[model samples]
Target chain A: MEVMIMKRAIGVLDSGVGGLTVVKELMRQLPKEEIIYIGDTERCPYGPRPHDEIEAYTWELIEFLLSKNVKMIVIACNTATAVVLKEARKRLNIPVIGVIDPGARAAVKGTRNKHIGVIGTKMTIESNSYETALRHVAGEIDVYSLACPPFVPLVEAGELDGERVRAIVAETIRPLQSSEMDTLILGCTHYPLLAPVIQDVVGPDVHLISSGDETALEVAAILDFKELENDLDTVPAHQFYATGDVVIFDRLATEWLGQPVRAEKVEVSGVDA
Target chain B: MEVMIMKRAIGVLDSGVGGLTVVKELMRQLPKEEIIYIGDTERCPYGPRPHDEIEAYTWELIEFLLSKNVKMIVIACNTATAVVLKEARKRLNIPVIGVIDPGARAAVKGTRNKHIGVIGTKMTIESNSYETALRHVAGEIDVYSLACPPFVPLVEAGELDGERVRAIVAETIRPLQSSEMDTLILGCTHYPLLAPVIQDVVGPDVHLISSGDETALEVAAILDFKELENDLDTVPAHQFYATGDVVIFDRLATEWLGQPVRAEKVEVSGVDA
Candidate 1:
């Protein structure tokens, strides 16, 4: 039984390289556990898509992970988590965790003045997931949410730290300056890469909460609680699969995770059911 | 199915009233979910007991909660979490969460200089659970642990603030002033009540991580993941049980939770199996 639990890898899914942020955290926290990551880069940027389409794509990704017999599943993309987390949890018996609640909990806990801000894709902000979650944890707190669609693109383009990116971030967050939110939730997994620029724009007094780090912690606790942790002495190799250009995916994965990664392109067509 | 999910209460167990901190957090975060708390006050201060005795006492509490058809369980005491979390998860089918990992994760994330401190009873510090958990999440960091046995007793006595308590706190934490730990884990749930004095002694530069709050977040996340969340609109009355003096338990529970509590006494003699 112990060997079976140790052998089963954790499944992580994301819309694109954005999920790599969560994967990076999981790798750092659970070094002994094997990870199988799948990035739906072909349908990358699930933010702009309709809810039905996003749900379908997320289901396809989940199906692929289920095929690999993962002991647990992590929805690394905020957009996917917003749309499909409830339904997925209902259907699957294994543990399934998303990024929103963890981030919301941290933001609520860190905030002293009962005021918080959230920045994410348009769909995530529109869904009101963070605001709802924050209110669920902390009743009647002021939640100000903004849709920063351009942030993900800049992060994907590797424009993390420069004058132009900083200016864009500053201009985007200018409206929140007067809101006086002491804590801000980085609602998207991709936002952590742009943390320095965001921090500079938001000023030093505001705390930035990362969803990936919080999600990684939740995953670790769940792993221990479920007794699925890998106790083997041998080092485990991580596996990555993408439904888009393999070379680009491999490059981004390596860059974001700070390690050499060989991302393979696989066809996940007809998995939308 | 939804009705059944909504009706099942969350089971929380502790060595004594210290677990009320966790219960307080659960009431704050998951207001709609029903809670069934059992305090093994008859075997209070499990911290000084043998590991086997502690494990047996913890299982008795778990069995009592399981008899209530609880949807989940939270080990609110650090010493109990250190000794029984692994075995309980292996033996039970429902989700089981402990306080240590969540507190460890938050401390690791909150710290900037890779230096952290932990304060708990002798057993918790001796168990090395927090150190192991912190290392599991953030590799190669400096961990300084101190056993603050007197703190819990002071809290149990309701001596949260005043010059006398402050003096005790200052003297107790004087050793860590030079350690320069940016984050400190209130490893014991009872410590949060003394947070003000601890913060004053540790200085404003250090962040205090509460296991109760963090564990509450983990419980909320697990509830959503397991599809066991109570989404009903009606308010749920919380149930409390104790194995010691019912009047004292009720008084402490009412004082700490800032609400009226009806505590019932029950005998758990020969429950150690």
Candidate 2:
């Protein structure tokens, strides 16, 4: 077989620290690949914002990453991915990926009764992104969507596993338990950290799907198929950029990304299409 | 001693059917109080919406009841109360009660240590409404806030006492466990039904505050102060109204509110000053 060569980095962007979760999975699964991550913490929660703004903000981030010569891009924010993925895919020449399809596929495989519950950002739930994806995969499957807008802030605040968080989660996710869903998709990447709590709330019968893990697998598959798998000899270069607090991002990156990561602050001046 | 005039009706309103929990407490505590409840079920969550919108919606519900000649109004939705209580207090002719103060007061009194964990909807937490209320009652207390946006939807979906709801509860509220909070505030009225799950998740050390219970005490206090207390009656009149699914509102009201209440569907016009 001829030797395959890839020169560019893989771009991953999220509304905030949540995308770091997907980066962690990518690091574990695609060790040789150089990764560049941008967390838009400053204008986070693309969830409640207007669709046009979400689309514009997402493209601006993508363009920023593209300027760095990224070979592929990952839209990690559920809200962003829900509304902008199609436009982004068309606008970019390089491979574009989002967390929704992989998560839905995984849920389809994981579910015993074809009943699935999806919880995510307001935009994600409002758009029925996961429901559409799941239905596209298995037309007969039932999809229940609940918008868990507060989870992002709770995680951002660094209260991953606390009583206050638990009470909020228990109260927030209580409605999902009423459904007969055998699987729950952690529609937001930030949600995996909350997997244990979600698992507890959904019960043993319901399987929990991590969008990060599933999306990572999808990345691996795409790279393998395209023959673009990186085989760098030296230490892998991983750069993290945030439009918010670099200090907290550094702490969270170290916690989520496993390796020591120094995240630099990026100032996004204006919205670009 | 002067003879006191009993109030004709006690009005309770929530963004959705979750406020039935407060009505449940009210029914148990004040059996003779005629309850007129309105659940903005069509817009079940006032948490994630804009403050202005929440204020407008609350006033609309309050206005609807005012037209019905309600004596006292209970703002059962944490989000609405957080954003609009002050405005409601100023605008309404009758006594306007919010669940936050009562709930915060209950948390302060119940806690052994001053450390407290508060959980509510996004608006409730983001507004720092509960924290403010708690601090006002007890000064220099360490308060932790987490917004569980999915909670009300979860409870409404019927996952009250189960392993699934329990797991989600544990995960979401995990942060407060380490804070060594002696008391936890269920800042949203809907949160009371998840009390067992919340208690199990938080373990035995933390005492959980039910907004319903606190509001019940407040109702009693207000009634007593206003000299509107009524004698125990064999038959109580409890009327419920919903802007959305009357069937669902009635079902949850019967389950959570303790008494079988026939709720009517009403048009939710804008709230006038």
Candidate 3:
């Protein structure tokens, strides 16, 4: 039997285009690693879906990337990562990393007052996944979690900041402000995109941790530890695939990635598997 | 035969606390009416969820409100309104109203340039419901729909205007600005909260429509037609319920509603039925 070598491509999947946030950070942190991204725009906002459904959808994306023979898998979407990471790691041949643990670790490390705030999709918050992760490391630390449900949609629509976004920021986060937290975890991948707005709302004293950046660092460490770092001579390129409109994926990718992206359309089915 | 008089509250539900936005408008539009508002804080960001799940969840909320004997239902969430309004109307005994059609009607009536821009959740943009509503009323007009996914999270996190939110806004709406659209529709109920940021991003030529406010008008009209409008003689009271933390809800409600709101925690079950 011939052995297959893992390719340099780092596979990333989100319920939709928000995973580009991780891709954005991955590009900055690991410049030599090519990224193969799959955004399931066809059925996104995995936040509210039943656990079984989310698990299935996430696995489908993972299988697609695995079929490409990617070196590793990154569950970029917070909801998917929160709900399915363990199962994914168990099933995948290569290392499967998620955003929650890295983000929780960073928040734990960064907090000075022992008061840390966490924000993400409603389902993520409802699951208390971050609280669990934070408690696992530092049980006595105070973890405040709020679900900023509409945030991903706002980011996707491109209304990042303004009076409307500000008001919503004020409304959504008023809960955290009263708690007097010193550091806040930007738990959702889409949140870093709204860092300025969130920072302003939480004020200067609160430190905002972008899980995207932290997760990228985690990816780097895992790659180095496993001797899986892509060779430097290769020019890293990013390819985007979506089940939705290619024009939308391309526009969003270009806007998010800071470079022109041509997303190819893929016909994917058989997932009632 | 005995005739019984019953007191019924108007039901309003949003993906999250942003429906306080509709509450604000409702307070202004129908000061004497009692509002029974349900915000699905535990499972929000309905914009990105699958159509079936969104419909099921929205119906769940509707069923919950119906159990409360609500005279009318206001779907203050954009995604919920977009994906489930007709079905909701068909299923419920009370009058069901959504934000999009009312907002689209207002945009059609408000625009002088005949070119309108609509922004909301990804589901809202994908549905083209706003465009469909606008075109149905005025066949020759041009409509542009932009999906601003991150806006809600930014606003919920309390960042209205900041460098990060601005950069994201600039990047997302730049293409629309170049296209020369004059009137903009805040298609999402949560969007009006980000109106200032959107105005700054899109510039002054574009008029912003608050779908929340328009929906409030629809509520008022329906109330008047049905003779369900509350009398202004007594002090108006608004009741807020959340499946999540009451303190978080109260804090956000007070901030968004301007007046102090003491939200009460309520058990919500049988939403899917």
Candidate 4:
């Protein structure tokens, strides 16, 4: 029972495996803390989904995580975050965090040219959440945003490397080449996995801000501030859950996490209560 | 009267103008927010002071800031923060931010080599706060710490340029020369003003993490997270206060802050009922 009390994991919700980047960072930054991740991979890519449906799915993920008695809630998916984060923050009792704000703050601080480029899914870009977060930090900041529709699908499919993928990435992000942005924000969590290719296209001059790394740091800050850190020094057996095929989820989870992981298949239909 | 509610400035307290680095970053990051800075310049170097005395002076600064009804409190001084931040965060009603944790988290995340260097006042280095913070973030990390007593006094005297200061900085930080720390946390907020010189000494390969920039980013994160941001769009009339000579404080403030300003003298004897 004492061990159970110390085992309440940080609940992480994402549309799919893209949030692995955040998980990777969270593990690296706060190694002692346990994480329970819920990936709504059945309805993967919440970007094109309607706002109402997105919110419902997000709540389902939140509810599942909460049932396990999570200490905090992290909206690791940009599309889900853009849709449900504000409402979830108000509605939930636990401290709620989103990927957008951290990335925004980082881009604002890291940019030398005062001009930033952001690439995300259609919903994330259309929401203009990054622009809002960036402008909220510094008024004089210039933001250039693009929605890379093919990017997420490519990541989810594990088409992350090779000349074909590089060509696709180049053509997809070709519009922002002339924007003269010194800093580029990997607004979508999935983008980091494709970073080597993206860096190849964008060149070394443009700094890439990973939302996962930034958000993980923010989580550490909030945990410390709130005095909600799990004090157990013992390593935790981290858990991963998926709403779709368990085999693929496990494979990718193991690959991205750089460790062996077994993903449990979960049904995220409607709310339990 | 409506404007009065929104005009509550972020109260920033430093031993002296060393924290002006934090204030400068805060203003740049959160431009719309009002700021009220109090520099305890009379007892400028809080490094050599006793713990009990430092705590008392910190409380005095907090009381003065509270009297003005500050929206947030930032302990921008390294020595004071090393001594008083934990207690202040627990005692204060509003959010209280410190310079150390932000730098710690940034260093942990920024370091690829896992070997980091930290430089600060004697008191801050003695506290081993950075080691505690760095170890807290990730285990099996190497940390090299040094106390450069002259850096603060040099910064206070505005010896920010030329070969003399550079030689002093190089000689002072000479102990950590071959440590091979890829990331260096300018653990003292005063250190950033001497960055060019420090960068020359440490070499460009060593990434210097300024507490001010990282702390400013944390302040923004906390403000947005806690819903403590000031919403007014119009410019705010920022105020400056000094416990000692207003002339030197005003001059240094203007030089470091890049704006002309006047500093008012204030007495912080004891707590007000």
True contacts kept of 2: 0.00
DockQ, in order, for the candidates? 0.35, 0.01, 0.01, 0.72
Error of 3 at A150 (Å): 2.6
Candidate 4 Cα outliers beyond 4 Å, as residue runs: A1-6, A270-273, B1-6, B270-273
Displacement of residue A41 (Cα, Å) in model 1 is 2.9
Residue runs of model 3 more than 4 Å from their true location after superposition: A1-7, A270-273, B1-273
**Could you tell me the lDDT of residue A16 within candidate 3?**
87
Model 4 Cα lDDT, one tens digit per residue, B78-164: 888888898988888989999999999999888888999999878889899999988877777999999998897797677997989
State which candidate has the highest TM-score: 4
- How well is each residue in A152-198 modelled by candidate 1, as lDDT tens digits? 88988899998999999998988788897999999999999999889
Which CAPRI quality tier does the interface of model 1 achieve?
acceptable
* Model 4 Cα lDDT, one tens digit per residue, A1-273: 755655678999998899989999999888889999999888887887777888888898999999989989999999888888889989888899999999999888888889999999888898899998888767788889999988877887889999999999999899999898999999999999999999999999999999999999999999888878777778877889999999999999898899999989898674232
TM-score of every prediction relative to native: 0.88, 0.49, 0.49, 0.95
Give residue B93's error in model 4 in angstroms. Answer: 1.0
lDDT by residue for model 3 over A69-172, one digit each (tens)? Answer: 88899999888988788777666678888888777766655576778899988888998999987765445678888998878888988999999998988898
State in Å the error of residue A27, model 1: 2.0
The deviation in Å at residue B18 for candidate 1 is 1.1
B-chain TM-score for every candidate: 0.97, 0.93, 0.92, 0.95
